[model samples]
Target: MKNVITISRQYGSGGREIGKKLADKLGIPFYDNELINLAAKESGFCASVFENAENKATNSLLYSIAMGMNAYGNQELGFTNLSLDDRIYLAQSDVIRKVAQKGPCVIVGRCADYVLKDTPGVINVFIWADIDFRIKRVMESDNLTEAKVIERIQKIDKGRANYYNYHSSEKWGRAENYHLSLRSDFIGIDSCADCIKSYIEYANNK
Candidate 1:
């Protein structure tokens, strides 16, 4: 069976770029926003719903609690109730698994590393960069002011961490959670992809 490569990345850490480049180098499909589109199509849901839930977790614990309550005489009030984020994530997770079944691919974010954990020959990688490097990348890419860049970077990274940690039972961006943790700051994106390719080759041979 072809191997699967799942990449979990920090915000503004060039993870998506690295994944894309790696997929190109390896001649495989690159799944990032493509997952959102596929999920929306497969689930018959609006794309915006999946987009919104992309790296965010539900903050509505009260909603879940209320749904769990059966005190009301109204059955409809507590029946088949799941938070919108949960539904979207469930749908996306299903899609991720299906896509992985097709063959080798470079999957970016969306808890894909965890989603495919049980699959043999799956390689999980986490990409990170220094705070200053990430901030500069955010600023240059988004054309945001330094302050806004910092704020957005922090908020997005927190969302990613919370989403991954809540769903995966593992720490996001921690070295132990991944087979490889590469610093985009130390090596350029293409070089990073080359390194990952070599690692994949070696693992396949072993």
Candidate 2:
């Protein structure tokens, strides 16, 4: 059976790098922003639209009603009538499902665990780190001041939490929602990847 790994992560925790390295070690495809491009192409929406709506929650009641109508109405007409966020999400969800169906792969962020919840051979992992570690990582990587990095981290994390909580039945960043939750700062990024690979092997054997 294929081993589809979904990694939900905190910003600057090196989750994306870990997922890429893990996929390389496992010889499987890695998907992160690739899903956004695919969703744009598949849905005929601009790539910018997907990027803008990525990990964002739409809380407008009117928008939700419009989205509901679009979901039930004619495809082409309804799609154009739907909100940009709804269109991007539906498109990404479809692409995520198709990607999982293709074979074993590592998918990062974008609520992929929720997208593939019912799919077989899926292992959901969440990666986080100490706030200090995350802030330092982002500051160095993005060439930003500590204050700027902290602000960015908080905003992005809040967006991720809101998006995950709004779209999924489970709470964001909660240990219970994932099969394995790791503190990347404790074990390091490469070690975290190795741990996930080992977990996948163990899970596959079971």
**Index of the highest-TM-score prediction:** 2
Clashes of each: 0, 0
lDDT of 1 at 28: 91
Compose the digit string of candidate 1's lDDT tens values, residues 135-184. 98989888999999987877677777777766665878789888889998
Poorly placed runs, candidate 1 (over 4 Å): 58-79
- Best candidate, lDDT-wise? 2
| lDDT of candidate 2 over 61-171, digit per residue (tens) | 443454454352544565655555666777898999999999999999988999899998999999999999999899888999998998888778877876676557478
Model 1 vs. true fold: TM: 0.88
Residue pairs clashing, model 2: none
